[model samples]
Target: MSKHPLLVRDVLKRKHFESAKLIAGQQGLNRQVLWTHILEIKDFDTLINGGELILTTGVGLQLERETQIAYLENLIRNGAAALCIEIGDYFNYVPAELVAMANAHDFPIIIFEEVVRFIDITQDLHTYIINQHQQALTQLDTISRTFMELSLMPNGILKILQVLHQDTDALFLFVSEDTKSFYYPIEAKKYLHLMEDHCQQLELHEPIQLMSIDKDHFVIIPVNGLGQVWGYLCMRSALPKPSDYTLLNLERATMSIAQILMRNRMLQERQQSREDEFILALIQGEPIDLQYYQSYLPMESRNLFYRVVVFNMLDYANTFSEEDWQEIQLQNVMFVRSIIKKLGFFPTVSVRQHEIIILAFYIAADDMEENRDSFNQAIQQIVARKTPQLFEQITLTFGISNVYQSINSVQQGYKEAKTTIQMQHNELASSIYYKDLGVYRLLLHQDHVALLQYVKDYLQEILLIDQKNGNDLYQTLCVYLACNGAKNDTAEQLFIVRQTLYKRIERLENILGADFLQAPHRLNIEIAVKAYELLKKTAPDILRF
Candidate 1:
């Protein structure tokens, strides 16, 4: 049913207005009449509110030509929808100038050739306006109930959009905060790019905006929840302007969308809270009930592999406020979870201060190596797709633990992941797996004093000589050991000639012994070199003499 407002043309169809004749303003027959009033006073500045049809005898118009003109102008300026005058008493007819003025301003003036009761006309039009209002309220109530019922369905969001589309017969678009767009009828997908481009220009808290795109009009309403705008609801139509009833439907639809979003957010927050507790218990080595483990974990069988991944945001806390930092952590956690899920792994995520921890589950395949490779490749993909769109200046470092088959060993896996991140030395690689740490794994567990002494025992003489003379002895020795004592390879790695390398090696052997490169000594020296590099990165002061 049409819910458009009462217009002047509609008013002319009433019995009380049967004798009425339109004197001017043919262009304004479409003007909406919200209410009707009778005015006998010459002063009506406060009496006329926009969209009221004024009925009167010519008593108010029995003045000079300019006064009559001013009276009409006053009514028009205050937005009276139309003027219905009884022409028998007080004055014989409306002036010619008044008719010309009414037509010019598109302000309707109606004159009754026969006598008509002002009371009957007001009562009839007022009843119609009131009944129309009641009908609109009833329709809105029905629509609201329909939306609430649809919100409980499995595909509630899609169904809500469908209801709006069916009601308005217009294209409906929902653009999420992540820039993902959902359209009704599928063919509306053609407007995806245009909607996204316009969304970028909208402020989060802005009210509904009516815009014209390519000669078609769009009504954009913000879907707000949880103290922020979660997305936008857009309606596209060929009409130059939406009817008030259509706008009401769009508002109702927006509220339903916001309710769904808010409900989902609350459910997710509760789930995340439980997962956080579970992850904390696992990492702290607390005993967990079997029922709790199965509920929170994807443990289809005991043959599955469990691994922990830790992500640390670098230098972010100092840059943002505490509130903003927490928001960033949440955003990053969601991003990591989405990417991990896309790769077909079950991920339980938790955020602790500046770090985000994820416990990823993988079902073991017949080829264990292939399973491990696939997991590693998934991690690489996650790092590659890190949230550059949201936080361009943010840098993240990831550390993965060794795989464990038993839930009891998850604590150890957590320790391994933390160690891999702590002892990380490669600046170029953002992600490091525990098994790839090599000798640094052993060095990471050694006591600081013991590690410092071991480095001193093997390289103390060369370090002191290099410090005293500003020489290349210490660096040359590290390259020579790394190159497996190959003179040509060592020289090339050090960016020096073979003759210069020979001189450095000669000085090195003179300081220590000729057999320093031999089996046990060579191994000890290599361990010392690795220990020294670790200390230089993690504890430079501890390496001092």
Candidate 2:
């Protein structure tokens, strides 16, 4: 390329300088050029066009500290090559604020005294501009070539990272998902730990970081697709606060790279899912005994039997973005299957996340009991090893369905598993086996006779008060006491007189017995009330009591 390149120094050196004369020595204004007139010395913000190293007469331009600060800020944001204030005209000095802001942003401001022609200084610099333009084009061409070459390959993520590291000089690893701690371990050695943490962070949409493995600055660019972040590609560099423009540039360039990686991975997973379904269908065969699936079971149409084990993550559905959720599905599918394979549960069907179905299926019903310990152990391992918050910390409940001989039998197990999941909600932060979860106790504990006695007793107390006075004593108690005996909370809940509720409790407490009147005595009543929440449908008529 024919060269007329303007180096940073050349930019300052260009232009003919006539004899120097001082204008505003006190105000600290430097003029690089003397135009026929200081036509319009606009700040960088309003100066839309590039390549103008503007000049101004230092005369009454009104350089207040604030005005000077604004001018400097505008120049920095808009890419002023160097600030050249014509000090000879008016102000001779720069304000503390102006100088400080200028130095902070790195815009070089110059000064001049004698009248210099603007055209003489900068008109011939077109050759240098042309050379600069060509060099920029060459760099762009090179990056483009590298981008395309990397994009075409199958291992695009590793390939892109490898290429980027080679060019940019650093280590690259996908980001870890600890946002608060902001840990990022470069190099693939930390893959296992990252996977564990990534699983934990799946419920979150924001960026996460892991340990600072190598003690370098880290940044995560999300690998987002299908409206969620599938993963993040992490990079470590020397620059702590890389400019937004530079980061933006990297973001734009990496979008396609991330898209390719996510798309390729999703396609593979979806393909595997389809293939697994196909194999299950093939195993069941087309001429299935549909009756085995339909009548006796809640979900009857399945041809392949899958015994599901449901473990709820610590996070709720609301926490994950739509993208994070899909990624969760993909990840769970992979993780569960991998675990099963490791545990010698080969060729088993596994479903991930809030599925109407998830299982290790088609094994004989008799085999279910035998596999319980192994499955339980696998689940325990999942809980212990998976990074923080993989299972909903509230309860790590796993519901296992009974094995059915026919694919249709899966519905029975599925229904049972769901019930168990709900049943063992109390055992959050731990796992449960379906048969072991034992929902039958709920039925026994909430039997009609027991429920009727409790309701009838409460009603008698209500009616006795009602008989004495016509207040809706039962309803009032329910609402007020629903506050769990926080008298203030109850009063607030009922939007009624706290004194009145206190009076009602006093009158009712005597009927129930002295034991039920104390501060702690209300706890059993609270339990009974909450239990009623679960049992109300079974004892619908008693609900009024």
Candidate 3:
């Protein structure tokens, strides 16, 4: 338990202090007094320490108005809790300039109308200070035990905030690292921005630093775990400053919060481990007994048609280092989970090395087409709402699959989603459905390997040349085919002038043999381009050959 001091207001309530009149710094009555020092010397500022109430007859302070102001400023600078001057013994009145200074800095100054012995005042106040300290220690021990009990309970952040609210009667806020949202008692949600602003101050100051907002003081404790700051907790009170015991309580609460977060994270990791196993089973076409994984499946998925949406982080490879990349992916996974829940979808989200697999369920409705549209709309809504909040330079390629009736059919759906992802053009679309890539499916038949090899052989020279020159001849050939070999349309689609498209085509013909654009050879080029795309999509390792 940490010690606390008595405030000036507490001193005013004492029997010995009744005759003392607060002539200035009325706003600072709540400042805590660590001790009362009776000093009549001019250089007492050097002899005393902070939080000391200076009790004197103002003997050395009766000087020029400027000197008196300087002396008062020195006391303020030295952190005197308050200055009490016995008016009858000194000049008839306290200087107006000194009073002005006292009021301006909120440095409490009390005037004694009657001659009160400084010794008696000091002795009585010191006794009270010791008693208050001892009583505070007892209260601190009780609070520490209460905190331990609360931490061990099955409750979470809200429960923690509630206990603190009862203890301090002050609003509590918990801000996560993203600064985008926070947690508060439902009654205190109105002060969310106030919490966020205090969080920013916490980040600005050293951890454990105390700060204030308006009339309230706060202590911000960063919830640290495993060498990283997960978030922060802010305890704001109108008590001028938190008592030492209250500060200690905040420290203990922070440790408890960290424990809760770590425990929750461990639990989530275990749960996700099981979820990942189920996802892998579904992706591998393993026979799923509905009853076996029933607990893992959301209500929307039971006995319903389900499809897959694979969101590949396009910028994951180059944007972050290995350690940072993993953390970023984890955060994105959690973020996606929260957003899906908010969107009113019970999503089964699984994280792969670079992609997040989302199994979206479609419950049969009166109108199947309308249900499909709703499902599609959900995915689109996510892309629209969440795209901007991702890493600034990051973009996601969303690949969705056609819904399948049986859970076992999800393996094919997974492949379709992956294939759709690989078919992404240089266009601005963030999502693509497998049905949109119908032409590419023709290239994925039994002869896919041979056909893929043949296409590679057909375009090998152009592919190699493009790789060497950092050019897009292979892509140009694909676009030209996709545009039906029309130069103007391909040029427009490629966002290049006709002259540039003509140059690329000329280069393609030279490397791919002069007959590359002939009707019969053109057909081969088109098939080979489509086949190569299919190979890269379905089996990227084949392209190494």
* Top candidate by lDDT: 1
* Cα lDDT tens digits for candidate 1, 27-144: 9998888888888888889877788999888888898988899999999899999999988868788889999999999999999988887788888888887888889889889999
Residue 119 displacement in candidate 1 (angstroms): 50
Error of 1 at 473 (Å): 1.0
C-alpha lDDT (0 to 100) for residue 294 of candidate 2: 35
Better candidate by lDDT, 2 or 3: 3
Show model 2 residue runs off by greater than 4 Å.
1-7, 10-116, 119-149, 161-247, 264-445, 457-470, 476-531, 537-545
Model 1: lDDT of residue 429: 26
**Candidate order by decreasing TM-score:** 1, 3, 2
True-structure RMSD for candidate 3: 10.0
**lDDT string, candidate 2, 1-545, tens digits:** 21122433444544453343322222222212111223245443553443355566654346566666666676557554555565545766656666666666555656665566655555555555655556655655566567667777766656666666665565566543322121222454445465446554555455433334455565666665433444566666665534333354356446756566555655666666644453344334444444442332234333334455555554455577877776666655555554555554533343344541344643324434346667767776665655442333334456777655455454456566666676655432123555564334344356676765654554556655676788766666677565545777777676777797788667666765556635575555545544554555444565544
What's model 3's TM-score?
0.51
**Which ranking of candidates, highest lDDT first?**
1, 3, 2
lDDT of 3 by residue, 1-545 (tens): 23545788888888878988999999998787889888777776568888899988878777777777777888899999999888865757887788888899998998888888888888898887778778877876777677667777876566778877777777788787432344455756766777676665554436676676677676777876544466788776676567777777777777877777766764574468767778888899787677877776666444466678788876566666887766666656665665555444556778877788987764664346224565566656556545333433567777888876666777888998887887774332234877766556666554766876787778888888788888988888888877777888999889999999989988877777777778888877777776776666566677754
lDDT score at residue 219, model 1, on the 0-100 scale: 84
Each model's TM-score? Answer: 0.55, 0.44, 0.51
TM-score of 1: 0.55
Task: Indicate the residue-level lDDT of 358 in model 3.
Answer: 81
lDDT of 2 at 306: 49
